[model samples]
Every structure is written in structure tokens, then in C-alpha cells.
Target: MKRPDCPSSSHLSSTTPNAGRTWEEIVADKQRTDAAKIPPEWVLPPAVVAGAEARRSLVGAFIEGLLDAETCRITDMDVPDLVGLMESGAFTAVQVTTAFCRRAAVVHQLTRNMLEIGFNNALKRAAELDDYFRAHNKLIGPLHGIPFTLKDQFHIKGLETCMAFVGWIGTFEGNKGTGKEREFESEIIKEFHRLGAIPIGKASCSPETSNNILGYLWSPHNQQLSSGGSSGGEAVMQALKGSAFGVGTDIGGSVSMPASFNGVFSLKPSSGRISMKDVANTGPGQQIMPTVAGIMGRSVTTLRLVLKSLLSTEPWLQDPYVVPLPWRELEDCCPGKGLAKSKPTFGFMENDGIVIPHPPVQRALGLVKRALQEAGYETIDWGPPSNLESLQIHGHIARGDGCPDVWRALQLSGEPEVPQISGLFEPDGPRDPMSLPEYQDVVVHMRDYRNRYQEYWMSTAGLTKTGRPVDVFISPVTATAGLLPEKFFHAEYTNSTNVLDFPTVVIPVTFVDKDIDVGDPNFKPITETDAINMAAYDASAYHGAPAAVQVVGRRLSEEKVLAMAELVVEALSLCKAKGHGPSSVG
Candidate 1:
């Protein structure tokens, strides 16, 4: 079975009339149609586009400078705050939607992040929301009037689901006569509609966030670095405040890694905690390691709210794959929950003993550790089941079928495999799939690995001063702060959590400081991959990139994980107040 996303095609290059045109024609039509959606006034001038191209950073002042003061102020506010303003009638849904749509337009032009533009439709829906609010004299729901974007993998009623494949451009997941085009809506979209959130656009989705479609998406924080990917475009959008929040699919750190790289907050929950129903996915019958939809936003608060809102819809009732777990406020886990009890203990894993993160990431972990300690929380060095164990289980269980579907999807339009995923295919086609017995063996290994990991987590209670297992463990989101294109060399930090099926949240800690984040000169390599990862690190090249950490919790622990993330954010803010915070460094 192919991935749920259905691989993309190049072009039919129709040999007969009415067959199809060239890949170039498809790409041009796609771009032209998407561009037509943006209001004329939102179109960017050539000079400004040139200026954006010349800069290393397009975030903060750079991107905002292009927008009007109101749009900047509106877009800068996080989701919860924006919804609050709407509830108070200080801002209408149209106002919020228009602000984000305009800013998203500017961002798409500058970064090529948007794969499907829906500004006109978004504004129309926003008006309906405003009318409902006016008639009801009350807010519609928790997420009322918020604007959001999603990876192009989700089928929205008024937009295309390109998934960044040129051949898949005008069709519904590469099927020409499916009749579902623009008619079928993903389950999540239904939930979002009920909550009153308007989707402004769908973003680019590629193996490394690139394809023949919208081009490569660069990190808004540091133009020289990768936006992290398959969800890279969504991460870049959130980093640039293109939307109030974003939804991305993650099979193996797809959402978390990009969020970390783009300097945005993200939540990659245990598979069933969030609905994957109706979302275009990566693999089929691949439940041993299923792809999950994750939320990315400017802050943990935004991530928390979005997840909670989705849960409030009780998506499980409609999507069979969703775990029937309602949003657990887990009030007892929130700050000030001590009430004479011990504060939450935390686990810190600076390295997996396989690959050492670069200096920027090391500093980020150090900052988190110190902040947690200073805030009166107990911290312990964490050593769980070796990530190498997970490294073994992930790929086989994920693509044991050899991803023949991906090849066929690309072949539909005669599109060749992309460089990032080129190695995934053979010279002629996808590699032969592992036999069922072999695949089953890998599944058994994954089961045992997960069991061992859980046991190890529980055993940590014996090591913590609090006499309780650590509430969450902090680890690097990736070994690199910002990727220098293909120089990225490790995914153990993020992928291990996926294999374990644990819920994880990523928080941006600080900017990569070429000076302050100087790495150890006498470091010894633990393994060949480690050596290559370290050797790939160039402090100057990674500078200006965001350094981040992931807070990981046990399976189905999304609420607790989110609460812990807030704690980290608070602790870091406290550290900054003392003038020695990671934020103070760069």
C-alpha cells in the first residue's frame, strides 16, 4: 500500500488530445491558480521580493516590515489571545482572518510556503463566523474566529491537496476523475469548522519540504537553513506567523523536527490521541508505526489550545482511529498544583550516547536544565532504552512494503523521485518489500522495545529525589540547530520518540549564537554517524538559526506534556529576567 498522501506525479505529457499536458504546464497552472487567490493589493512588489531574497532572516522585523502595523500586531498575537479578543468583540473573525490572510500572502510570496491559497474563501468563512457571533451575542466556540493553515495533505472543501507533487497538482491525490476534488473534506476540517477556525491555506509538503511544485521552503529565521520537512512549509508558516496555528503530519519527526528548526512550538501526540481520519497520509496498513497529525504554533499555549479544542470536539466519536480520550485538563499537573505535594520532577537527556548535538543544541539543553533546577524542580540524567533500538524498528515497520505506492504516484505523471527521497527508490522502481515474516519480526521487535522503554521510564522513580518517575524528559529535537541543506546527519532524538509512540512537544529555546555556542574542540566521536554529524557542524553557518528542545511524555500523555512545556517556558522566562537566560545570549 502507498502512503495515505498518495505519491505525487510529474506529468502525463499526453501523447493524445485531452490526455494531459507536460509537468511544466501542470506546475505553471498550479502556481497561476494559487496566485490568483491572493487579493491584488496583497501581491508583493519585485523590489521587496528581491530584498527578502538577499536577507538571511525574514522573520521578526523583516517579514513584519512588509505588513501594515495592524496586521503585524494582529498576527503577532498567539491563538488563545486572538480568540480572546474575538470573544470580547474587540476583533471580528473577518478582521483576524483578513490580517492573517494578508500576512500569509506576503509570507507565501517570500518563502513559497503555501501550496494552496484560500484567502478569498477564508475571508468568506470568517464573515459567516462574525455574523454568527453578532446574532448569538456570544462566541461560537473555544476556537471561534481563529485563522489556521495545514499541510497540503488535508483535503479542505475549497482548496487543493497537492502534497507538493507537480503531477498531483490539479487532481485529487493524483486521481483525475475521483469526483472528490474540493468536495471531500477531512474529518479534522469538520471539527475545525465546528470550532469556528478558518483555514487560510494549505502549505507545501515534501520529503525535505521541496518538490517541483512550490520550490524549497527556507526557514524564516535563517534563510541559509532548511525549514525541516515534510512539514517544513507549515513550520515556516508558523515561524513567519503566516497563520495563527498549523497542522502537519508526522510519521518520523516530520512535524517535531521542522517545528524545532523553524523555531515554533509543536505537539506530536501518540497516534490515536489525534484523528488521522480523512487526512492524506504516508503509508497504508502501516499501523505498526502510523503517521499522526501534529499542531504547530507560535507558543506552547497555542499548541495546547488547538489540541484541547480538537479533543473537545470528541473527534474519537467520529474518527475510529482517535483514542476516546477527552482533553485531560490535568489540572493537578499545572503550575501551583503542589498544594503541599512535591513539584514535578524532570528527566534531562542531553545526548542519546549515539550522536552528540551541536553546541547550540547543547546550550539549549543546558539552559533548560538550569532553569528547571532554579525553579525548584528536581532533575535527573535520563538513560532510557537505547535509541539505536528504535532506529532499528522505525523504517522497517514504517515502509516494510518498500513504498511501491510512492513510486507509482510519481510515475503517474512521469515525475522522477526527488533528491531527498531518491535513495528510497531503486534505479527502476521501489525496492522489493520485506517478506511478511520478516516484517512481523520487526513488529515484535518494536513491541519489545516499547515495553522495555516504558519499564525503564518507570524505573527512574528510584533515581529521582522526588521519589516519582520524572514527569517529562527534555531532549534535543535534532542534533543540528539549523540544517545546512543535506548536511543534517541525525534524527534519533526525534525519531526515537515516534517509535516509542510517545507524545512530545518542542519549544524554541534560543537563537544559535556562533560565539557563545562554541563546541568542544577535543570532543571524541562515539560512532561514525556521530563523527559525521559533528563534522557537519559549522558554528557560523548555523548562527541566527533557532536552537530548540523537545519535552517528551509517555503515550497518551498530551495534557501532561503540554503542562510541562508551559513550565519550561516559565522557567526560561525567569532565567531571562535574571539576565543569564539562553534568550539573553543571542
Candidate 2:
């Protein structure tokens, strides 16, 4: 079991040799000379392959010949097809689960996306489902035997929820003697378990999915680019089909931004739709704008399936914070109903008009507008109030408590904060907690902003051909497709939705293209921040990054948001076929 390249205990007699080597020296030596020290099953090739070795470590060799022909064939199958196979006995749960696990193993070796490996546990559960079906002649549930991964933040029964903090490696949230370490489960975990979805493992995450545990999470679509953080790991996993679906948490744009950045779909509901109970948080005390669990997946239908099944468990009964309302089947919101009966009006806001979207993002928006118009959907220019209001409101409420809770958690181990979260604190400690009056003032401002936004939304009724309020307003998810480190300037696209408490569905509409996405010649700066954000735009660096739009709905109206998202997708498809301007996923 001794690796050739790695030093064995037998070789380190008395540990008197090379003990003074620096950490960087040790790591560099391992990377360059200790090839055998690398785990064979985890090395991923840079390219996609129709077949590859299931048990090899060489990235290129593995992907070039990674799986049994049958497994490789089934691995590329989508969710609905996989479900059909399960229902018809075309494949057993073991077969499907094994294929995905192997594929996931490869993905991890290549991307280092997973934090834990629960393939054995997942296969065991899959076998149990097979037994249940044999005994009762029924599917376990809608997501029967489906393999999925979660953001490391979710605690599973037998796995650790490290959330990428090294301090939390052995103890429960960095504490020992806690009985709940592996015994406890997140609310979402419970629901997924009941739905017969097995967790193959947990994915890596940075503050933007750029944490220390797994290093940088790169987009499978383009390894040279970032996967998008917070949920970057989950997004990459889904992009590579390492899981049937994946879960992530979004406070600002954690979930949506990654999904957009990695060319996947995600739903970031308003606070109460999904449960966050029993989940670890950095600053749990700041409950004003709480982080909610969101789903990321290959398709919108899969995301819907996960959400609908979670709702079936009636999570509200167990978690008091969960909304009591069940998932209302909105036949009224269906395209054939509200959307088809009228040329639904869409309020189009290209940019917040604060920080302008980069060329690729702008091109993506233009595509969406033309698609909607071609599909007989009315498009109106959306000129809303200053996004600067939410910019002010976000930081105050999101981190105003001085992040004492976050500080305490970090102190669990004497670990340095990751590069991504370094800006959250000063050299001394977390910033001072805002006073109660100032905090209350921010909250008041948030409330006023919401009412004014709603008023503006309603005012669109006068301008629309349908003479009704805009069905859904479309806007960029972020000012750019993928962010380069701390280049982000405007969070208004996402923060404004949070301030308004509106349901927002992020739809990946395009990729950053170096050739087509050029700088705007007539672009004018709206403010200092706007200028800085624009200046950070690099067409080449951003190439292949996914750009997406958010479909904003009224508070807690998830059904409507999803429905409109589908319609938008359909319209975009048609427009693309007809050779119109940029269509969805440009």
C-alpha cells in the first residue's frame, strides 16, 4: 500500500532528513516528482470521451478508455430517459448508480469537485430500492435511485459537512464530543432520502466556490475559466453529469451565479420555499436575508422535479421556518394558459443601468429580447429606479452584525480565511456590528425599495399591449458571465431580488465569445463603481463563461417564475432556428 513517490514511514527513520523543508517545497516536490503519490482513480483527462477507463488515474488515458461500453452508453443518458429505464427494468438501480459513480470518480479526478465520496452508501441505497420494487412492484418515489451530490454545507447521516473549512475536518463544525457529527442530517437531505435520491458525495465550494479544501472549482465547459462560486462545485458536477442533479445554497448569487457561469440551470427561490434548517452557516445570526437551499441541474425539469419532491415531504411541518404552503400546481401559470392566451408582456431591463453588462452578456440579452418578440411576446423597455438603493441595503443587512457568528466559527481552528472571503474582515477581526438604529434604517430602506419596485412592476400594465402587468421582468444575473477573482462591482442584479424578496430563476442563455462579444464603443459610465466594473471586462479571459438572465416573480411565486423560464427557453429555441439575433444560450 506504500506509494512509490510518497515517503513511507519505513523510509523516515527518526525523521531526521529533510524536516526543514517548507510547505511550498513539499507540495512542489509532490506535484512534479511524486507521481505515484497521486490517487489513480481521481485523475481526469482534459477532454470529454465516449469511452474511458473506470479504474485508471491518468486523466487522458482514463477519459480515452474509462468505462465498460454499456456503462459509458448509459452514463450520457438524461434524467427522464434514466427514469424510464428504471421503470421498465431496462437497467437496475445498481447499474445506473455504478455508472454515475464511476463517471463521478473521473470527474473528481479531473475537476476535484467532490468533498466526500459516498458511492458505496449510494449503491447500497440503490440496492434497497431494487428490493423495494421487487417486493411491492412500485417505484420508490419520483427520483427513485437517482444519484445526486450536494454542496458540502449539507450534513448527511454518515458524511461530514465541512463546508470547505479545514478546521471542521474531524469534529462536528470544528468541535469534538458532539454526538451529532455523522448522525445528524440537513432538512434537504431528509427529503432527498425519502424521494429515493442517493447522495454520491458532497461538492466543493468557495466563498464563490473557491475554498482551500478542494482548490479552485473550474467549469467543465471551459477548464481555463472559473466554474463560478459559492456553488461552483455543484455546477461543475451537474455540467459533467456526475450526478442526476446537484444542490447549492444562494444568499446573493451563490447558486445562480455558478449555474450561470457553468452553463447549467438553477432556481433560487425567495427565502422560505426551501428549508435551511439543520444546515451549517457562516453567520446564522443574520437571519434577515437568510441563505436558502437551491437546486442546480442539467435541465429545468430536473430542478423542478427536485423542488416538487422536496415539497411533497411537507418540510414545513418539521422546520418551522419552512413555508406552510405546499407546492401549488399552477395550471393558471402554464404557457398554454396565461402565456398562450395572451402575448405575455416582458419587462426588459438590459442592465441595472448602473454597471453595464459585458458584451457577451449584452449579446445574450439582445438574443432573449428578439426571441420573445419573434414568439409573439410583447417586450417593453424596463427603466426601473436606481439599483444603488439595493447596493446600499445588501451589505448593511447581509453583514451588518459584524459577522460575529462567522468569526466564532473561524476561530474553531486557527485557520486563515480563504482568499475569497479575506475581504469580509479587517486584519484584526470582523467589522464592528452595526447599531440597532442603523440596522433598522437599512431594513426600512429595503422595505421601501420593495414597494417602489412592485409599483414599478405594476406600472408596466399601462405600457404593455396585453394591458396587464408584465408577466415577468428579465434582467442579467450579474453584470458579467464569469467573474475573474474580485472583479465584481455590482451585485444589484441579485441583491435587488433579495431586497424585494422575489423569486428568481437563473436561466443560462449564452457563453462569453471573444470574437463576437466586443467592448461597447459608446458605453458611458453611470458611476464610479460602474466604471470600475466595465474596466474589469476582458473579452478573452471571459470566453466560454456562461451568461444567464433572471426571471423575477412576485414574492414566493416560484411556480410563475419557472413557467415563464420555460416559455423563454422555448422562444429562444425557435428564434435560434430561424436565424434571428442571439437566442438563449448564445
Candidate 3:
């Protein structure tokens, strides 16, 4: 599977060479080649791009105005409807591919969110899918002609994965002369190909790189705010409908936070639920708390379909680290799945006990709670092991090595550490790695916390009418309505999920309404962090940003979590009908 026409390095021209070039020269050349990939006709005028930058939001009318009617209609569709139309010949594969690529070109041009662009290769593959369907009178697979984006860490064929490190610009993960460069692909890429999903491009990865390649990627929903954690680029792409869905990696809130911030649905499955094989990573040796691939899309159904489609390929056979579990029909508690009569009772989180969520996040959590109660489902307060315990264990397990490898990657090209991640290292170099005994102590603490949490979860069976544990618990995805630079507060809820290895789904509930969601006059701080966090909440600063909640199921319970997420969505819809749910706009 050699990636033809995929240059290992972006050539300056027929006359120029890369030898002895400065890192600046290499970076400039890559950006030039990437922008050149978009068709000239699709490029927006400078004035339009400038106007978009000046605006507070890039979605809705501003972006839709740039696309033609047909492009708008095509790109607006979710994954399932796109596949159905492609299967029925109502739209050719090339049509859908071109629509998304056109919109993606606009997205990258406006936000600088693309690390690599592969529009030509994607169009060629879309034509091939159309050929297969014409010859066989059926879709090539369930995801036929669907376009998707990934965080730049994935090794997509026909795309160079620099992962935003300048030292990695012209090599296979910082090594030169490797024939596998740009030719190698991840396990999930192979599964996607088999299902006929096309890769349009790679999105920005990390470090809020306004100074680097994908310049200043921020929230598409509200440009005033930070997009989110590391998965911000992919989340913005989904928010703007650049593709049908997207894939990202999350160790803590990397995926969930951005999805929540941008107002989209995301599933961060427990490690081993999805394939992570051959993906580039910063801490490759950190397996005690393994990283997981997360899916972000327009709806819970799309997330479920994407995961189930991957599982159908039996990914466990290739990636042994992936669990051997297939999609469990019995576990899906969707309507008509025979569990309707026994609707799942939900656990509700008023607060995580360390830091309180912002007014908007608090409202989102309460809305979900009331929605469920109004829809005939039982809701109970959820209290488990303290998030502070998970916080300590997560730091050691995730970066106990002091992130020497991350520091080395930056030093490879002398790229200064961005302010976002500068805290991970000392002024001069990485911190000392934890000793074996100390690291083991953290692992032991993690196990104990997990055991206690599980005991508390199981004990809920005693409090329910059905005498069963609450199916899944819902809580704030983050403490803020949207992430703003230097305005950090709480991550206990998200960090604890990784520490406990639970499958969690982020459901976008509402947006920050400065008019309605004002700070509580009697709000009492529970900790120093809480006091500082609440003090920073200015209503005008956070207006119109998305607020969301996350649903957590027990470990490896993705099926149940997703189904329960669908139920939450349905319950919200029920409340909306009753005029007691989310507002139409912030």
C-alpha cells in the first residue's frame, strides 16, 4: 500500500532542495504545499477570510453563506444519511466527497486547522467507491463515501503526520530515509478503508499552536474561547461540519472537553475498546493508564454506528490490546431493544465536591437531571471516591516519566515549548522520572481508588427501586462553559474517568446565556481552587459558548453508555417539547 504521489518531504520546487535548510524554511514549505492543495475556485477572497476572523463565531450563517446550496445540503448531513443516499444513488460518492472537501478547504483556510490536506487522493477514492457501487449495485460498505478527519497523530496514507512537531516535518516520525514515511497507515485507517470511509485531511493536534503550523485553532462556535484540550482541532472541524465525523485521542479530557466546548457528541471509550495501533504518541511507554481513541460526530447514533462498524471488522484480531468484545445488542438499551419497559435509572452529579462547575455547566447538569425525572426515569444523587484521589494517581500514571520524550521531540527542532504545555517541564529540562517504587505506589493508589469507586457504584443497587445499580451517571464535562486561556479551574470529573477506566459520552446540553445564567450571590467556595475559579467567571466573557454534560458507565461499557446517551438526548427532546429544556440560542 505505497502512497503514490505522497512526498515524504514537501519539495520547495524543482530547483530547490531541503538540505541544510532551517526549520523555518521547512515549515514555510509545508504550509505552502498544504494551502496549494485547495482548488483555486474554492478559495475564499481575502476580505471574506478577514471578515470571518473578525466575527465572534464562524458557524451557522457565516460559514453556510460561503458554500453553494448543494454543498450546504450535502455537507450538513450526518454519517448515516450520507451513507444511505450514497447507497441509493441519490448522490454519487464524488459529490459528497467534493462537497465536504470544499467545505473543509474553507474551514482550514479560515481557522488554519489542517496539518495535511489530501483532497485529490480523497476524490480519487470516492470515484472508486462509485465504480464499485455501479458494478455491484450496493455500497462498498456501511460507511461508503463518508469523509472523516483525524488528529494529525494518525498515519493516514497519502498524508504526512508531523503531529505539529517541526522536527517531524520531512521524516517518518523524526527519522529520515524510511520508505514507510507517508505510506504507513494505522489499524483504524485500514478498517475505514474496508468500510469505504475516505480521509479528507488531518487536523491540528496540540499546544494551541498560534506560533506554529495550524495557527491559533480555536472554538468555531465562539471564537472568543479556546477550542479545548488537545482534540480541539477535530472538535472544531465537527462543529463546522467539515466532515461527517472525526477521530481523536484522549488520555484525560483531550477529546471530551473540546467536544463539549464545541457543542458536539463524543464518545471516549475505555482503553482497548477502540484500536490505537500504529498511532503516533508523546508517551509511547505509558501503558499503566493507556490512551484511548475517541469519536466525535453530530449525534450519538453516528458515534454508535462508527464504533459498531469498527467492531464489525473484528479489530481485536489485529490489535491484541483491543478487547475481543463485539457490539453487544443486549447491552444497547435503546428504545425497542426490549429494555424500554425497564428504562435505565440515571445517577446525577450536582457537584464533583472539589470544584463547582460554572453557572452554565451547572444549568446543563440540572437540565439533564430534570429532563430524566420528567420523562419517567428515576434519578439519584451520585457520590463516589473523591476526584482528588484520581487526580494524584492520574498525574503519576500519565506523566510519571516526567515527559522526557515530549521534551526531546521539541528539542529535536529547537521548538520552544508552548505556554499551554510549558508547565509539564521545568525551565531548563524535563523533571526527574519517578522511581519504580514511587510509581508502583501511585498504581496501588489507583487500584484502591478504582476498587472503592466500584464498591460505591455497586452499592447503589441497594438504593434503587429495581434493586439494580444505576445504569450510568451524568456530570459536568468540565467546570467552565468554554475553555479560555489561563482561566483553568476543574478537571476532576474528566481526569477521574481515565483513572477509573470508564467509558464516557459527552452530550452537548446548551450554551452560555449571559442574560439568564448569572453567578449565584450566595455561592460558597469549597476549596482555594474553587474560590479562584468562581472569581474568574465573568458572564460577558463566556456568553454564547457551549456547555455540556458527560455520561459515565462502568469500564468497557461503551454499548450501554452510548445507548444511555441516546436516551439522554431523547429525554432532553421531551423536556424541550414541554418548554422546560434547553433554549434555542444563547
Model 3 agreement with the true structure over 261-371: per-residue lDDT tens digits: 899999999999899999999899999898899999999989999999999999999999998999997433675333345667899887888899899999998888888
Cα lDDT, all candidates: 0.84, 0.75, 0.86
User: lDDT tens digits, residues 1-586, model 1?
Assistant: 1101223433312322124676666777777887888888999999988778778888788788889999999999988889889988899999999999999999999888888888888999989989999899888889998999999999999787867766566688878989998988999999999999998889988777868776666787777778889899999999888899999999889999999888888999998988888877657678878899999988887888889889999998999889888887776667544321348888999899999999989989999899888888888899998989888888787778888878767776665565677777777778999998998899899899989988999999899887888889999998889877667678888889889899999999998888888878899999999999999888887788999999999999999999989888888888889988876322
lDDT of 3: 0.86
Cα RMSD of predicted structure 1: 4.2
TM-score of 2: 0.88
10 residues in a row with least lDDT, candidate 3? 1-10
Q: Model 1, which residues run further than 4 Å from truth?
A: 1-18, 336-341, 584-586
- The TM-score that candidate 3 achieves is 0.95
How close to the true structure is residue 586 of candidate 2, measured as C-alpha lDDT?
Answer: 23
lDDT of 2 by residue, 72-151 (tens): 67777767778888988888888899888887877776666777778778889999999998898888888888898988
Candidate with the larger TM-score of 2 and 3: 3
For model 1, state the Cα shift of residue 81 in Å: 1.5
lDDT of 2 at 501: 75
